[model samples]
Structures are given as C-alpha cells and as structure tokens.
Target: MAKHSFEFKKKVVLEYLNGEGGTPYLSTKYGLGSNSQLRKWINAYKEFGDAGLMHSRKKECYSFDYKLHVVELYLTSEVSYQELAIQEGINNPALICNWVNRFQVAGLDALRSHKKGRRKTLDKTNSKDATQLTKDFTIDTSMEHVRELEDELLKLRIENAFLKELRRLRLEDEAKTRDLLGSSTVSEDNSN
Candidate 1:
C-alpha cells in the first residue's frame, strides 16, 4: 500500500478514537486496508500520543559514515558478513550491500532506509582488528611483513571465492541429479 503522511494518519486515527466516525468509515475514507489498521493507529495514538505519530524524515537510511564503516569492515577486516550483520544488529547483510552500493553511486543520501529505527553501533572488535591490520605495516621497513600479510589475505580471498563457486556448483549438481532421478522414476512408472 502507498504510504500516507504521519499527519494524515494521525488525523484519521484521532477522528476514529474520538468517535467522530466509526472504524469502517475512517478506513474507507482513508483508503486503509481494514478497520484493524485504523484501530492500530488509534491504539498507537492513545498509547504514545503525538510522539508515536512522529516520523523521522531521515528514514533510517545509512549515513555516509555508516556506509564507509561497513566497506572498511568488509575490505580491511577478516570479519564475515554474518558476523558483521550480528555486530551491527542488522537482520540482512544484503541491506548493508545496498547501503554500500547506494553510497558508492549516490553518495550519502542513498544509505538512508526511509524508516525510523535505532542506529547501528560501531563494532569495537572490528575497529580493533582494522587498527591492528594497518598498524606499523609501512611501505619501507615493513615491506616484508606487508607482503606476508598480503599473501595471507590473498589466500583467504581465493578460499572464499572457491567456496562460493563450490557452493554454486553443488547446488547445480543437486538440481540436475534431482531432475534425472525424477525423469527415471517417471519412465519406470510409464513402463510399468
């Protein structure tokens, strides 16, 4: 359903609550799905008052800093996406990717979610890891150490890429196997 402004929702909800009109009338008038939705608004208003109806213009989109931080974690740190998601209290890593892409293309404005919610906190563990990874590994005296770390990181990247490829191949193989088995079973049944 299309979103209505908070002001419009509040007006309908208040009218319903004050018995200026019944739920059905308000629902029809406001083009809401059902009386239940109208009731939810009324209940929300009653419980939280005007504060509950207030909407954040920012819409929970990721700030530019947040997007930069996520990219840093993925690129520099050894943290997995799942681990990062858990640390950031995000339910989906794809959302993070979306934020990253948005930041890359549209800059800061793209990171915003268009909903209001609590902000993600910085992962102290990841921050510490990033610090340690970059620390004292200069271009001159630490070249050897840098090379060693780079080799290890390269190995990890290869392993991660291989694992992803393996998973894709395995899924394809499974699908083909299932198809063959199903066809064989069908042939047997037809012959019988």
Candidate 2:
C-alpha cells in the first residue's frame, strides 16, 4: 500500500470524527485502502494525537530474539519491508533489510552487537608462529612480498625511462633552437 502523509492521515481522521462520513465512505472517497486503515489511524490519533499519525523518528534497539523473529517472519511470509516495519514498530525499513542481510550472512550470531572502531592490525613480528610477537623482528621474505616489490620496482623503472626520454627530447629541441639562432646571427653578420 502507498504511504500517507501526516497531514493526510490527520485530515482523514478529523473528517471521520467531524461526521463528514463513516470510515467506508470517507476511505473510498479519499482512495484509501479500507476501513481498517482508517480505523488504525483514528485509534492512533486518539492515543497519541498528531504524533501517532506521523512516522516515528527514533532509533529503537531490538533484542536478538526480536531481530530473529522479524527475519524469520520476513523469510516465511510475503510481507513487504514497509508492512514489516509497521508491524514491528520500526521507523526505518532499511534497518529491517540490513537485519535480514546480516542474518543471511552470519545467521543469528551476526545479530549480536559488535564493538565499533577500526580492527586491530595483525602482528607482523610473529611470522614464524601463530601470532606470537618476538623481539627479533624478521623482514618478510615471502614470495608475495617479493612479487609486490618487483611490481613496484618495474613501475618505477618504466616511469624513469619515460622521464629520461622526455628530457632527451627537450635537450634535442633546445640544441636545434640554439643552432638556428647561431645560423641566423651569422647570416645577419654577413648581410651587414
């Protein structure tokens, strides 16, 4: 179903309350889904005033069970994200999508909260053993490192050769210009 604005919901609820017409007639006239939708809005308006008609703008924390339940519901049913959000009292549909994605990737364990920050870098000193940091730091002579260094050296060599060629060309151009100037000066002297 299409999302209705706060003003539209308020107008409909007020219209119903003001005896403009019953839920069925007003809902049809306004092209709303059904009387049930109108009734929901009216109930919300009665309970929370204008705020009830508006979409919630808060970041609500969900329990692991709740997240699992929602994901399972989504997987089992053909419910859209908006409908799920409405049912779960979640403001953001994207949050549900993310939960489903996480559940798919790592199952229920992924629903657990993770510590925020950059991950710690692996200890490079323990090349010989399993993450054991030793005082004697050894240089990495791995084939992967060797290949990476070789690739970088090859790029530098190519850049150096190109620069040398450019310098040679510039020097040649300068020499030609100097020779032309000399010849021109000699000719002018002869003409004098």
Q: Choose the strongest candidate by TM-score.
A: 2
Worst 10 residues of 2 by lDDT: 130-139
Model 1 misplaced regions, further than 4 Å: 58-192
lDDT of 1 by residue, 86-115 (tens): 567554456676655665566443544465
Candidate 1: deviation at residue 69, Å?
26
lDDT (Cα atoms) of all candidates against the true structure: 0.66, 0.75
Look at candidate 1 and give me any clashing residue pairs: 59-114, 59-115, 61-112, 61-113, 62-111, 62-112
lDDT tens digits, residue span 1-192, model 2? 438888899999999999999999998999987787888788667766787688876646788767867876776567887678777766556788998898767655577676799999865544565444432233444655775686456445545665676788899999999999999999999999
lDDT against true structure, model 2: 0.75
Tell me the TM-score of model 1.
0.30
